[model samples]
Target: MDFVHRKLEPPDLQDCAPQGTKVTDTDPRMIYHGEMIPVGTPDVAQGLKDARRALRTNRFRPTGRRKSMIIDGCAGKTTLLLQIGRAYQGLLETERRPDSEWTPVVYINVPPRRESNLDWSLPFADFFGMDHTINIDKRTYRSTDMTEPVAHAMRESRTSLILIDGIDRIHDSELTTAFDYFDCLQDRLRVSVIYCGRGAIDIVNEGLHNRRRSDRPGASEQFRSSLPVMWIRPIPFQKGQEEGWRTVLQSYDDNLRLYNHQPGALLELDEELHERTRGYMDTLDQLICQTAQQAIEDETEAITKEALDDMRVGRNEPDDDWA
Candidate 1:
């Protein structure tokens, strides 16, 4: 017997909205929140796979700590990290130990502009479902006092992965100390670590260079030799990939038609949108949301070229009318 392949259908518009309400009547926030459909670009998929491999390879290292660095611009770094966290969490759930009570993967955002390394303990504690305030007695706790509880929690929980997002946000003065803290975490906890941020390659390289020249004894050498950096290349809108744009639009409104079924309607629309947005996933997301909301407000069944053109103009205008 022969079987024919079939393409997956778009999600129901109602599914993107709240229960018992039409998508058109649903608030924009509600719709936008549910629209986190990653396009699965090759670079993103490969970067995630490489990160997981790095985690597995670093799991058994003792003092030779290795980390996976995901370098990307501000455009889609957070989204990619969130998606990776979700994917890693799902994989961990599948292989969850029967006796383990803690989550296998812990994702924490690096605090922005905070110089103290102890501040990181808050997010780490929260990830393990512990009260960070309990560790803080009179706001005077040693770094070990704060990190020990986190280590104990991970030990009890059997967490295998640690994902630190926004490492680039660490202040210049605190950057070296932040790396040292993470090195200590891996050395003490013996868990896999992945750091995501923009322009981290230069910082890490400079730190390694400085460590090599200094007589200081630490894990800096281990980090320099073992850690593998994975750069997420930009998602370029290549030719013959118009279906990607269609998929994004259809996710918002399944009934959306680009140009009334014209011969090259989708192709034209895809080219224009890609050119305007420069193939940035974040920009694509914003444009889709903005265009979808405008269509709903205008009581139109489908977005038109005119509406897209107007949105593009408003986006470039200094008055901030695009938002």
Candidate 2:
């Protein structure tokens, strides 16, 4: 992902942005550094454009901002947030010098699996030297309450970019609690967030059970209007769209030798690979990365079509869904 993300350098290109319908390599804002089109399709380019613009303008908000995003190809939403935080942090460093005015872009990853009794609203407390001195008696400083710690962290670091990854992974029972935490932080903090992962279904509808009706019944517009939900597909190679995709994969092959021993070999099995992956970004990445390991184990220089066919057949055997 780092290799893919570095490409988003600056300049300013007309096309290729998530929204740009007609993209050219001209005046591109160095944004394409290391980053490959998750799914080399035209549909997602528009969403990418919107996301990039929002990030630049600090418009990714909750109630008024784009609250949700449906990212494709990548796994581990928390890790991706960390990466975005690092990128924004670097950008902040470049844009604002030490003496200049700028707040630290705090990256907070909340895993629903780790439901500690401690207050979750101000999770950054641990990151900003508040979680030290693990003492039952003196830990809860009146000044360092749930919200104060976050405010202090923001003031001390002087940042407005607050990234909170993983909103859908929480336990079913804690969904409302998590929303409360999210609502509190979003409403009180003066920062923007990149809420990654499967955004709530509400993101498409308006607010909560808020629904609407035109010719047909539909959810409220607030849900759809608030957060810009962009769905990223896996990089694909249509019947004739193989060259560009091959270039992208070969680059991957070159970087991960163990994975791409057959740098030029994937083209041969493109048919079968496409059939199984069906252009899903995450699954495709997993397939190729895994195949690279398989190649090393099988002592083969190239991934054979027979191997893929066998794997596909086995993958579809009875009870395959259980697997």
Candidate 3:
């Protein structure tokens, strides 16, 4: 079967009044709430730009350099990764043929392994709908190495970018083999790769440790001392730093579908929102999305301080005092 990667589509939301959106007996607004509304927060926007630049530069290169994006806290790395992927895909939509099966990008979440052995190629095979498993018995199976076929499929599909997420979940013992597979993929496919996770820096460092240096004269001098890295840290709520936080809140406000919500409602409570979410995008997203959904159900049609305070979402760390 030919696997055509579907582009990540944002929900087609109606203007602000989610209560009025009728898809079935259930409110269609629930679908919107289920998605992570892409906000162009400062860090996210910068990350997107860097990722795009890397992909564009490596589009026609014989070998692509690896890039890494590290998140200081584990709040929203996956969301940022998706945003970057979606943005890059959007850029290619104009150039992609109408009937083309060309999947310019591939996304994989590194699965947590119980043992040191992992079939790194399985993810790619799964993405492209290739059979990478061999039947061991009537009820048992083993994954066959699909690296070569996977690489060929990627090249055939004209895939230029690969996004690897959840690298932190990979066991330390498996890091060498995991990155080795990636290095092979990049060398063979000549595709731009963005490694993302909290431990992304370490992963990149390990991969670069034994990387083959070009034998061309002056190549060592031309090589970068460090891999390209982007950090996605939380927006601070301090005086000067507060603007980014406010901007993010304002984005949620703009996208919210509350009928009675006044303009700048969320912006006015930026400080409180920051205090509640500690400027963490994940927590902030959960808080706002849940609150908006609640307001809709309650017919309040507005986000209030009490409603915000009452909403409980996100993990509660021991040091967390945001309650």
Candidate 4:
């Protein structure tokens, strides 16, 4: 027992033996968060090609315009959405659009922990090049008061895009209610809404559609026409999924070389290290970064199976069962 451990009133992993320390999980990085990714067709390159075509053809409206699209998927929806949003923002800045035409973007995570009712109008202020402050605290907002304001804002903007991630976490009842607001708002606005989630938004839209189909004329058909839903099928992690993975693995080819570099270099367990992480981009990233830190503390030459295994699947040494 050293003074560092003895003197500290509160104990942590510092008290544990070197071997007991854990830096990261080598567990399966096959987790699929709600990311915006190119919906690779059935996880194949050609599938992606076809999906892109569908997005351009079937999803596009006259004048090459399109209503908001919902990219629904259970895995990697947020990552995918951010990627697309990033690309779109870059293009918006780079390419030439009419000075008068404004298609601002809104990226939000509608989690179970988020404000139940959101004010969509307030969020897009910055995107549209407006200097308005709405919903200053993201963590504390409830969306209940947003429908009217959001609908009004959408109608005002010439063209707009809304990218909402993690909406599935919001309850069906709330979502349906929200759909009513968005639908009514969409009726007033020609906005193209994009929703990214773990699964499909059809059920949500269906409920919203059903609500109006009973008494309204062509209401259900109109609702379907208003917002079209699309799914971003899983793209197989080919050579680590994206092309960037190839560069990553190539740089870390010599597993032993990792030890020579900065401490916490993830050991190249296999020549196809990048290949192994394909389709699990987000998960593998987390695993590699975390394991690297642990390797440094352990003074290991390279990331070992023991370390990765500990991260992915627990070693579960021992713990006193509390009553």
* Lowest summed lDDT window (length 10), candidate 4: 27-36
Q: TM-scores of the models, in the given order?
A: 0.71, 0.60, 0.81, 0.52
What tens digits encode model 3's per-residue C-alpha lDDT throughout 43-161?
Answer: 77887788778767666555435443443235677767877777777778777653456788888888654232247878888888888777876789877777788888899888877
Q: What's model 4's TM-score?
A: 0.52
Q: Write the per-residue lDDT of candidate 2 for residues 93-171, one digit (tens) a residue.
A: 6766644334466655664443432446446765554652345587554322445666665666666666655545554
Model 4 local distance difference test score? 0.44
lDDT of 2 at 232: 45
- Per TM-score, the best of the predicted structures is 3
| Order of candidate numbers by TM-score, starting with the best | 3, 1, 2, 4
Cα lDDT for residue 321, model 3? 68
lDDT of 4 at 94: 64
Which ranking of candidates, highest lDDT first?
Answer: 3, 1, 2, 4
Where model 4 places Cα greater than 4 Å from the true spot, the runs are 1-65, 97-103, 111-159, 211-280, 299-301, 312-323
Q: Tell me each candidate's RMSD, in Å, in order.
A: 8.1, 11.5, 6.3, 12.7
Tens-digit lDDT track of model 4 for 1-323: 01111221211223423443333333111111111112222323332343344444532455533455555654555645655554444445465553444445556555443332344344444344453433646655333334454445545544445566666665544555566655655555544456666543554555456542233344323445345555544234345554444434333322222232443243344333333343354455455545555555565635655676556512121132323
